[model samples]
Target chain A: MSTFGLWHYWVVIVLMMIGLYTVIARDNLVKKVMGLNLFQVSVIMFYVSMGKVEGGTAPIIPEQASGPVVYSNPLPHVLMLTAIVVGIATTAMALSLVVRIRETYGTTEEDEIRKLDRAEHE
Target chain B: MTFPIEAIVFLFLLATALAVTHLRDLFAAAMVFGVFSLLSAGLFTLMDAVDVAFTEAAVGAGISTVLILSTLALTDPREHQQPVRFAPVAVVLLVGAALVYGTLDMPYYGDPTAPIHKHVAPEYIEGAMTDFGIPNIVTNVLASYRGYDTLGETTVVLTATVGVMLLLGGLGGARHRGDAEVVEAAGDEEPTPMDRVQVARVSTTVLAPLIMLFGLYVQFHGDFGPGGGFQAGVIFASALILHGIVFGLSSLKRVVSPRFLEIGLAAGVLIYAGTGVASLFRDGTFLDYAVLDHHSAQHGRHLGILLVEAGVGITVTCAMVLIFFFFAGRRAAKSEEPGDRDRRVA
Candidate 1:
């Protein structure tokens, strides 16, 4: 019911759409990879956002504190760290595939590459 | 307290994402993507995910940009303009609406009473200090409680290195390290444009060592602060990457041979798994750190975490640097091809 409370999730959804649209519509292979990157990063942002606690600090424990210290959830950060590494791996693998495609067809446009493949088949 | 800053940052992230989607010039889009990553890293900071922010800024902003640019170098940079496709737009809208509808039932941002916060997180936050005695709960959880997951993640990085090498032909010129030409290229500097910048050369010579030193600090200092194997590995690899950029790949090959990287990529994963196997032999279950030390379980845990993190750092550093070499080297190899320059010019 409150816009202020749900605004962050709303913005993240919009960002995710921008990424997904680029992936679906863009012809350029590199740009498609970039779009995929954007989508993955936004998902990471969503998880980290969900982990935050109002008034909580980073999860590093302090030596001494006067009051009960509230720490943001550490689980998401840990999981997202792995997710980011995996993201880069996926990007590298995809880009390398694009490089191979370019070398074979001498072009990176999806439709152009498809046309070349069709001609080869014919 | 976070409303003004966090809201503005979120808005900027949205704007950047839009720009990245619309930019036709691939080079410009790649540059803007770097900016997008930095902005996202800043947003992560605002959310108190400092470690995640650090890794994102390094991997997303730094490594991804370099990889994309190199691919552009080997392939093309201009995105051919096509008519705005409404089908995708409609699809995205439908999906976004569904996602928003789904979010309505989700807990609000930063709500401590959310189901996630009430789950296993409290155990980690409390147990990290008493069980492992590490100040950084994230590290304790990532390195110990979830050690198997991290091992799998490190293997994924190694797998990536293998894939890129297979696709790009054996680390470019690195396989022929025995070639006198490559050795000569390493022995003496090639007069390239990057080499002409005395200030860059001098600064890089001075800064590369310092950056690697800081990487070491991050590697060891994760127990008390916001870093661990993944971030440290990327940081260290970046230092070598900087050296390669400033000094040329030939010189970098002399510093880190391709063979070293090939072995290093697998070595990291082995080190991680070896720790588990070692613990199994020591009468504890896999990855049980308490068995590592005879005197105290805490001491054993500290030692085990350190060893596992080092393994992760080594593998990551190798995988990243190897990927860079393969991509950049392909460009060199293609340019070396007869008539390739003429074809490019035409």
Candidate 2:
């Protein structure tokens, strides 16, 4: 593939990395969830990008077209819709877990939670 | 080569992602993330994924942002100062490089001969109109050809809501707290006074019903347009969420009733699964709508899709609303702690 052909994927890669970095590096639980959201959304963008046809319009079949229409693939779009919903569901669950963790540990920072866990064990 | 709109959207998305990462205030991060979702929705539109864009706009930008902001109500808005961690950065770099390298072998953007397009996608695109007489191929494939996957997805949504309910305690338990305590707790817990504004109340009053109507349109119009059960469910949930935000959780619970929501959640999943089982008893395969109408198989498919879509819409809507209720309830309960409130205010 040419350089122009691959730039989109590369940008998505950078985005995914940023999200991953945030999730791993952030001490706050909510920030971690936000990072996870970003990661998943970047992946969605990658899939949607691949489905785009050069000169194609939206995949909805026109009612009165005399010739074959160039339409972007709809499969990825359908799949990504499921992914998006699942992402939200998972994020909701994660946030709830964070709430419970806060209730128990009295802190949302990962390092403090870890410290508290170690103290309890010791 | 001409510039594509995707590049511009991606740039904005990248900037937003970075801002979300660097912002110490969780509230600002959440808002920036909403902007990020909106940009991605715009990009999805540019990519000709209108349904996904509509969904991203509603669910990602609208509901998730609201949920995250509500979550911030329970937790501290300021992120703790931590030293930059090198290990995660190194790991991220390695993984990102691997992904980039992997993409080298992938088909170029919009290449008609890409492997994804060469496979069953073409079959669905060509067969959708002939088999189901649905103009929107995505809906046809989601509800008919790949009905089982959608069914599984509905179940997942139901399962998540159940998990949230368990985490936040039973619906009946939440209701028994009474309105007075809930009102007081909401007043104590909520970070924003905006919910109390007359303007917000009036606007939400005007908009909630219209939003629900649009949700219905999206639900039934899936056959002809870029919407279906999933989008409709989120939109419907967003309506209730808006009401809850402006009118307070107590009023919303009074209107929706947690017990009714719980029933709605299960009913949605059962409706979806039952449709498939019904098809089986009629000597058709699971989720086969062709047997629904003996006169015309197309009509059967249409009926089956509509019923199953309704089931999906119901479950998703109920699940989202239930989750929000539990989250908000938990926040109210947490804020009731006298000592915790002092620390939270600080």
Largest DockQ belongs to which candidate?
1
lDDT of 1 by residue, A1-122 (tens): 24678888889999899999999999999999999989998899999999999989999998886799999999999999988987897789999999887876788999998998899899
**Winner by lDDT:** 1
Task: Please give the C-alpha DockQ score of model 1.
Answer: 0.69
TM-score of each: 0.94, 0.93
C-alpha lDDT of residue B265 in model 2: 94
Every model's DockQ? 0.69, 0.64
Model 1: per-residue lDDT, tens digit, B1-346?
8779988988888888899999999999998999899999999999999999989987875788889998998888899988999999999999999999999999998899999999899999999878999999999989899988888888888887788877775334445532234334333443474867999999999999998999999999999998889999998999998888888788888899767988998999999999988999989999999999989999999999999999999999999998888777666666655244232321
Model 1's lDDT to the true fold? 0.86
Distance from true location, Cα of B174 in model 2, Å: 9.3
True C-alpha contacts between chains kept, each model in order: 0.82, 0.70
Per-residue lDDT, model 1, residue B308, is 96
Q: Which regions in candidate 1 have their CA more than 4 angstroms from the true location?
A: A1-3, B170-191, B338-346
Indicate the residue-level lDDT of B47 in model 1.
94
Q: Give the runs in model 2 whose Cα sits over 4 Å from its true position.
A: B170-196, B339-346
